[model samples]
Target: MNYIQKGLLFRLPENNKDFSITTFLDGLKDSLSATLTHFHPLAARLVTLKQQKPPSLTVFLNPENSPGARFIHSVVNLTVADILTPTDVPSVVHESFFDLNKAVNYDGHELPLLSIKVTELIDGIFVGCSMNHMVADGTSFWHFFNSWSEMFKSRSFNISRPPILDRWILAGSDQIITLPFTHENQYINRPDHPMLRERIFHFSSESLSKLKTKANSECNTTKISTLQSLSALVWRCVTRARRIPADGNTSCSLSVSNRSRISPPISENYLGNMVQRLKATTTAGELLDHGVGWAALQLHELVVSHNDKAIKKLMDVWVKGSLLVNTSVHFDRNGVHIGSSPRFDMYGNEFGLGKALAVLSGYANKFDGKVMSYPGREGGGSIDLEVCLLPENMAAFEADEEFMSIVNV
Candidate 1:
């Protein structure tokens, strides 16, 4: 049986002067084996007993095909750094940044869809997580993290039982449901490379709170939550920052955790992709005018609208059968990002070594940029946003007067 799970990659700068490939793998293997056992005993047994399948594994085992137990598929990416002093956290931890200058081309079929090439650079590190959009959504990624951490630390991992759906069950449903795959002129060739940008922004708790308040007050609306506000703010900021025209074609796409939002939340903690995109757009002036709060309401509606039965039917039809193969509709738009709550507090990313000093991540193809909403520094009131963007765009943003006024554009 051949199966491939997209790999998520990250770069960790060399912290101390020492690192051992063999020793690190040793700890990771036992840890991953333990986690698989704890999380899905059956799957773990299949693996341990030489049953469950991994792409790295052949139907028949060869010496090289043996399962490498580490949940983390890792490697070392080396680069030249600017200096040779004792590395600090940012220097060591963020060395991923330096290696990012390398080329990435996911133009053809490949497995472990995501990968991290960690390099020791002259100035810093280059970090990224390249994965197939199918293997795991944000939530599943964290599940793997939590489980991996528990196993590595040799601690009891108490995981909230994830709802399990046998693939056969979904297959049965297909017999009764037909999805709309072909419409008149339905398939438009996806752009060769949409103008997707990568950016990361940082905000102190105070800035986030004030921004939320400003969004609410300006829109004359009260229902705007922090996420809604922030998303809208980012939309506006990027539009203005990138000098995208007011009438430029764009969409603000984000995720709705079907966990609590749906009638019978689909699955509590499944290790697979379970998410829908909420893509909404507005004229630049309208976006800037209603500001974050109003745009947030628009966002709310886009998602709620999908809750109807017809939409579900459409999805069942659209995603049915072998009609669809691996697809990553990577967009090249100037100002869109997959924004999310980093959910760091949940990932017990501890190895036998220690708590991870920092987590550096990026995505595949042209998803423009990415934004992660994380807990604030003090653990209360404040919110922290880690934004990843092109250095030049960032420079333009820092210097733009109108843009600075929004944040102070």
Candidate 2:
């Protein structure tokens, strides 16, 4: 399990003499406690049952021993403008999150499954959350964030969409499959990553619509979606920026949600990891020459073919192997991995201070080609792509004429 780290920044309302940091934090902590009552797993610990014939991992909720969640409140001299006005995300933003920057999800056995840090800026507040990927996926992560915000705003225990805590498993699969690793250290390997730069490229609703229309027209199919169109655009531009050899193989991986792909589809509120990474590979030359529409069609087709049967088959194979997901930042320089979805209401997570000014990600699962997508702050159908690349590649990517034409600075 890898930790999914993200932060939301909000500027404090002006001309308000009734603002007290102590009161705000007290409210946030109290609401978090109430919210955790419903999301029990976040407050629980994951333990390895080595006593079993083969070591297995299980979510352990010990009322007596479990330390609920770690909450830290810190004051920073930075302002909202320091974070929002930068063309490149500042390194200080990483300090907003807890000290689990390199921690894998398995560390939740001893670490807090959920760690929140409320960094008080000079004129704003930054709420950072780090959740164990083992406990949830992107969907569940945002669900918890939204629920916490709702609880804080309403000052009540009632949440609009209560989480469905039931864990999903294949019918014939063993209840506790053997884990591939026995000790936590077996999962603590961290390789040195190349120096990379991260930039959030904003694509407005109109730009996205134009891209989608162009892609669909080029592929002669209306099935290509806005997200796919955006992914295709990034893929092509990044490939070109990397300057890969003509015959070099490059791949694009999209994180696909399994909530609706299975039979008797699981609820959207399912509070666990129900996402699978599907990759479409091609030669770098082919990808760049094919145009955005062709690349979008390839992604669209990949998503369309992953139906209930395919999901079941994949689940069956996974159960037999019981391979734990590696959260390390290992990637081919020529490959692109897209995570998160623009459909997530990142900007709607209001914790009474107001809507978030921007959303930022922590230093986990970030490599040369990592991409995290979020809905634009202004909402509508706009999308924000948090693209990570090598410094040289980033420079080239930002300068690409075709890519910059659609990007809204």
Candidate 3:
């Protein structure tokens, strides 16, 4: 697992007004411990292998070594309606979540890999989880959350599915030259700038259908997917809003799950990071002049191009250390990252209360031009997008005519 931090906020409605805060917190802590018994790596520490070849680390587990997941209780005077007001949601939640400073690095054995902060609002409870990306990816992180929720709901030690902890499933290749390893090293210590901001945009199902229809019509084919259509539309809008040089190359890269792409499918229950980043590049001028269909076609081509051979080629590049640094690629240059599958079922986190009203990530503008789309909580065929951008670019992007036409504030 790479060094990454993923945050998820689950909004439990105020219908549970009778539930006491102390009882809620106690129940969550107990359920989390029970859940960790099954997913124990999260409670353990990483042991660095400084003398080993390929430079790796392994999770060291023991009864005494567990720095149990951190739990914090907070009270917010705002109502759930205020938190979901669209304009105020992003900055407000970002300021209220877990400690961003502690999330960056692992100090061998101190930092808990998983931490939960529950913010009690006048009308709801915000369950925020900060997970170390080094331990799991979004899929695995959610698996832990769902498992915890199951234990909370059923009060049972048995989980529906167990995660496979074999990190070496894809390891074991011949030694490679050290040169390729150096490419990712350059961007490892990159500095963080604080001028960036995060915001969410909603596109109703009707808007998504319109976008797909326009994209498909332009491409003279009906095969364009909703993701490709939306990615193309957003890529062009953000690129134009940024006002990059007309002839300069603008790129859109997607983080795709590689679970089923391998020769033999990896189980959805197979834990850890099983995603690969692939990209499509086009000149800014061409993108600006083209319709949604042209943009969709570029993305469509990028998706179809990633077969087994391409994945193997990517693995070869990664091992040789020539693959662009994953952290820097999505945030730097003229690149825009678009990810998240609508099928993730984020709205289903019931936890004995009613389903969540909304889901959000932790507050940091670590990356500009990054976007994550999720299914709407209301069960309409709608989509919710979480976007991070520089303050100026975000202002321009919010005012973008084409983008505004499709999104519902």
Candidate 4:
């Protein structure tokens, strides 16, 4: 199980006076209980199999073995308007929005794999979620959310396809084992920058189209995608903003989902970490000398290179404990990690009160060079980026001439 942590924050509008906090709390609690009834693995725990020959851990989903998901309710003094505004770009709301430390910093065994916190503000309510990456990936997590919301609104979980919880659908060598909770050497420490901050950047479809054209023109090829174009542009801006040395090695990595790429294709509903990181590396000078199109082509080629054979090889390396998954590794301000998908149904969580005012992330995303995207607030083909970087670099990035030319204000 990969011990990575992920979170989501949903903002609900002001409640009617008749709908008291107690009423809302009761609804949330009951809905969660109903949700667990279907997704029992979420309410379970990862117990160590001390006596097993392979020294493994398994998920125990019974009432006696699992204590259920953690639920928290609280009220904040801030109003929705104060935090959810254009001026609040690099939003500082995640830390105050939810307690991430309790989830990510847990000792895997003693804590619930899933936890939800409901914070009531002066004008609205926010729901923050923290789930262990070992148990669920983004798709599985959102699938659970869709089910929960369905149960909340329709009073039942009648979704067409339910989650398939078999961890080893593709049987491998006996020595191939799941990454354990004790193998905490996966993450690499970042620089001790005291003023790291996060900001949201919006790129309209038109803006993205213009960027795509510009990138293609630079490469003299029409092979790059909107995602590759945007990623290359951001990578350039961040590298330049940090003023890294010419010879310094700079890298950009994108998290690629392998569910569809595997040999026979893994079911979309099959729950596990079915994702890999695809990275492109270059020296600061090389990247700076090239146009956005050139950088985009590099990323495009990197993504295209991960064929079926490559994926299988990567999987083999993973099982052998030889895969150097440096997704969390920050290399001297020279690396940027891009994740999340614009295709994710972020704004669709209606929960019976209309769509969410704004969907957001938690403190886990506050690291430098972390970029995540979802559909824009106005919908359509627009993209909204939740970008995190050092405060100084962020200022330079926000003001970059080329970036400003295409970035939506």
List per-prediction Cα lDDT, in the order shown. 0.46, 0.85, 0.73, 0.72
Best-to-worst order by lDDT is: 2, 3, 4, 1
Q: Ten consecutive residues with minimal summed lDDT in candidate 2?
A: 56-65
List, residue by residue over 139-246, the lDDT tens digit for candidate 2: 999999989989999999999999998778898887766656656566556544566799999999999899899999998889999999989999999999989998
lDDT for model 1: 0.46
Cα deviation at 194, candidate 4, in Å, is 4.3
Which TM-score value belongs to model 4?
0.88
Q: Tens-digit lDDT track for model 1 on 1-409? A: 0121212222233464465546655675555556555434223111112223221111111233323222333234432333222221133333233222222212112222233333333323332333333445666656665556555665454544443533212333543332233331232233223333333344555676776787678767666666676677666676666666767666677765555554555564655556665678677767765546677677766766776364456455654532322224533356455544644453245444343323444322333344566544344444445454555555555565533443420
Candidate 2 residue 174 C-alpha distance from true site, Å: 0.9
- Give the top-scoring candidate (lDDT): 2
Candidate 3: residue 24 lDDT (0-100):
72
Ranking by TM-score: 2, 3, 4, 1
Summarize candidate 4's per-residue lDDT along 106-131 as a digit string, tens digits. Answer: 24467777788887877677777777
Candidate 3 per-residue lDDT over residues 220-276, each given as its tens digit:
999899888988988998998899999999999887877778777777777776778
